[model samples]
Target: MTLYTFFGCLLTAYGPILSIFFLFIAKNAQHVLLTVASIAIQELFRWLYFLLMQRAEPGLNMVTKYPRSPFNRIIFAFVAGYGYALTTSLVSYVPILVESLGPGILMVPSFPAASTFFDAAVTTSFFSLLHMAWMVIAFDGFAAKKWVGSLKIGWVLASHLGASYSTLLNTSTIPFGCIYAMVIQIVFLLISVAIIVASLAKKR
Candidate 1:
């Protein structure tokens, strides 16, 4: 039971991530490279990485954020998507995920059918998927040079804030707190999916 719980939570957390990468990124060489660099460069030369990205500001920045070709669009999206998903937010969770490898399964009282690890795993997967959507909408604004005035990106930002706030309810003190958090994230994720699909439709 203990090992089952551990692996169950482990797969729950990373399964979606693996699936998405395989479906969308693995086949694309550029995507695979960017994903690797996104995490690797940052870890290897933390200071130099930011310094260089800033230094590459003129050429690389414009190509990434205000890309002209369909290719550049993919470039920017990958940068933003992987950047947001694989950054500090991911690193911070690694240590805590050790909880998923437990001596016993820990259930959430307020949401008894779900274990705490499972709840956390679901939240993690949702964030990763949402980050992908966010990049698409955000790229629309950036490429259009409507950074401050883009309603689409603004909506994504607002949803992120609201989702973060809702996570506070992931506690026993609040009845159905975990349930509320899960529902909130699911709703946001659906909206994100719509945004991604809409963007893809526009491309087609």
Candidate 2:
């Protein structure tokens, strides 16, 4: 739970970190449609992955905003996701350091840039999956109780979508139609998938 809360804090604080990465890929491409599609896919996959891996539990279809039953489990999920995001954001600055301090500095554990792009991809994906997993876990009750009488998760969707587009704009300056760009996208997807797999394993 501590980690989850930390991630939530991180996401809120350095949300642009994600944008920056995505922008790099989106560089000079038709990111407008791709951005929308990517986010849509991300959201869909979050739920689908959860369903495929969900464990047998005593509960309704989903959670409510304000739970009538014990909400500890849901709280834990949210906190866990938030914590992962927060921690990642805190450490995200290390990559810049790695580039600045030169390759020699990357050898030091104290400098987070020592971590590779694969490491970052895995971490970010894990954080996002956990965040969504918790949401599903928490919202199962709201889903059961129609707790969305006032609160709407749509806002989250909107925020993510907006951020994706904004980041796409930032990325548009770079040349996206290139071998390196394609390789990067492929690697990113692979790392992200690995993260999702890792998170799902945790459920077991």
Candidate 3:
């Protein structure tokens, strides 16, 4: 059950990743097509990145190994991701209160009617939490062990930092204000390091 929760989080980013790319392209049939394409592209990159990481550090390869039951993993991953969406959506609503206090503080972009500030915020948060869970599950499946929440925290920090850098520096489609992104990155890095230390201690 816990393992499923972890996998759920990691694989849950599919919808958000696809939606981001879809926002870049023209809004037509191409949007749907691009969303599908983004999924394929992301999966390709994920596997490729895993392979590269495994080569660099064979020990980490356990994190990416598929579980005993592919169907179970899939169902659990989606359920975990979707379940997290509820929490994320609630967190996202807080921004609305922020907007009432002031504008441009967050600066959400205009996309599909459904992808507005409220929707995006919720979805983003959902994926973030889900990915965090995914990392823990992957660790259990691959590492065949569990520890204090520290390791998951560290992994999430590393993943968040990498994702933010790619989105902010490489891609020009930053959805949040500069200040907000910086703050989030800082928090993510700190939490991630803490997680890593905890996991390491457990290992020792």
Candidate 4:
């Protein structure tokens, strides 16, 4: 069962979301139980940024000579997310990814499907997208007059937690866990992208 799952994820990492790795990991999952700690700390900074942006909006009028663009929020969100994702990638995942280009294909003991370099790459691919997704959803919620305790924030945290722990599956099942991790991350991405598209069409 676990073996099939690992192969399924190996194909997925090399196939469906490979572009994501090129964009994010080449341009950022499971780091032990610390995945939990990392997600919490990362979201803490995002929430703090949201609060600061909220308070600064009133005084932002001082610099307004032209209309304040709604896209400004998105720009800031993406920038913050990109930086957060990049920083983590550089310090953690990039080390493993360095060997991705080599001819040698390293596998786990008794697990041929668990390619360490590529599995790490697959898991890393989801971080940048997830960061942007969570921020976009949370930021939009704030703009929509939604409370921090509302469904929007709830979804962000729930998805974040899900994606984080999904990698834990790898500890026991090897590559299957990484596959589970990406699937969860991709689900959150679709939801966030839909919300963003809707917001873009909405009248200010």
Candidate 5:
């Protein structure tokens, strides 16, 4: 997942440059098309990055090693997810947000400042929680030596892509305020923390 985010950041840096070309040629729902294309590209890049990382660091395969407590898994997931989100927001979203502030760059719709912040906060928290879920499930499957473990990488990528697409689509319909988004993020964090605590207690 960390590798995924690193590749995502790289793509995010280049996305705008491509958007410039797309802006000139694309017509009718250009922004929407761009969003989908971006997600697809990111997923592809993420997969390739994962393969490269696995080759470079063979030890990563030991991710399934046993004796890893659920509490530790949860913490690792949350932290990794948060780190991904932070890098993504700072490296990817911030520039787009800035661009949006300008006279509506072609193919890039300008969002209100509040909307941008709300979107960022919500997306960061949502993906973080999603990562946590993925880690827990993947680890459990691996520890049990289930075939499901083999599918964890693909599952995480697919889920991330699906969630990103859905979130982009829903943004228009849901239209959350900053305060509401913040509250939701906080609630998710607290719930995840509670789950981690529960896991720790169970181990004890």
Candidate 6:
């Protein structure tokens, strides 16, 4: 979880800069594309995070030392997701908060609108939770020595892109889009939990 937090901070700190670089290079890059890229980068970081964790402490590998209960997996996923959300917000928004207090220092273009910060944070948090839930499912499959179907990168990417796009739309002019997005995310989370439970039952 601590490692996840650290990686979240790194993303929060550097993500905007990378986006700006893309903007300058692509000349006609759409904001939506950049948003998708950002989410994809986060997912990649998640993969790297688990890889490092598995390497640094083999016992920490969920694939080998799987949690015995579905509830435990849910709890672990929630905690990890919450940590990522909190650290990501702290590193990304606190600077903006400080800037709002006085003169702005960080000059990253295309920052999220101040009006949508609350909505974006809420959406991001819930989406992060869903992402972590999927991770748990993926890891559980691996722990069962079934790597073929463990990773669903496309599903993960699509869900994140959907969430981010929804948030962005809400930020623009679409009213209540964030609420709809949250509902979709909640449904996804429930489905993931149900899948995890089923997987645990089968294993037992």
Candidates in order have lDDT scores of 0.65, 0.38, 0.39, 0.59, 0.42, 0.48
Query: Which ten residues in a row are the worst by lDDT in model 3?
Result: 35-44
Per-residue accuracy of model 3 over 57-161 as CA lDDT, tens digit each = 433223323334323232322333333333343454445433433333333342222223333343455444444344333333333335433454345456645
Residues 1-204, model 2: lDDT tens digits = 244433543454355446543554235233232223323233445444334323412332244333444543443334333433444444663453234333332222222332333234334444454343434443342343354411324533443444334323222334422223334434433443453355345545
In model 6, state the lDDT of residue 7.
45
* Residue clash pairs of candidate 5: none
Ranking by lDDT: 1, 4, 6, 5, 3, 2
Pairs in steric clash, model 1: none
Pairs that collide in candidate 4 are 28-124
The number of clashing residue pairs in each candidate reads 0, 25, 7, 1, 0, 0
The TM-score leader among the candidates is 1
Task: Give me the runs in candidate 6 sitting further than 4 Å from their true place.
Answer: 1-42, 55-83, 95-117, 141-151
Residue by residue across 1-204, what tens digits does model 1's lDDT show?
366766776677777777767887777665676566656543234334434444554565453434455445535465546655666446645655786675666777777777777787777777776766666565564445444427775766788788878777876577788889889988988887786677667766
Please write out the lDDT profile of model 6 over residues 72-130, one tens digit for every residue.
43333333433444445456555534333343322212333333334444554565556
Which consecutive 10 residues in model 5 have the weakest lDDT in total? 104-113
lDDT for 20 (candidate 6): 39
Better of 1 and 4 by TM-score: 1
Model 2 residue 135 lDDT score: 46
TM-scores, all models, native as reference: 0.74, 0.32, 0.29, 0.65, 0.39, 0.50
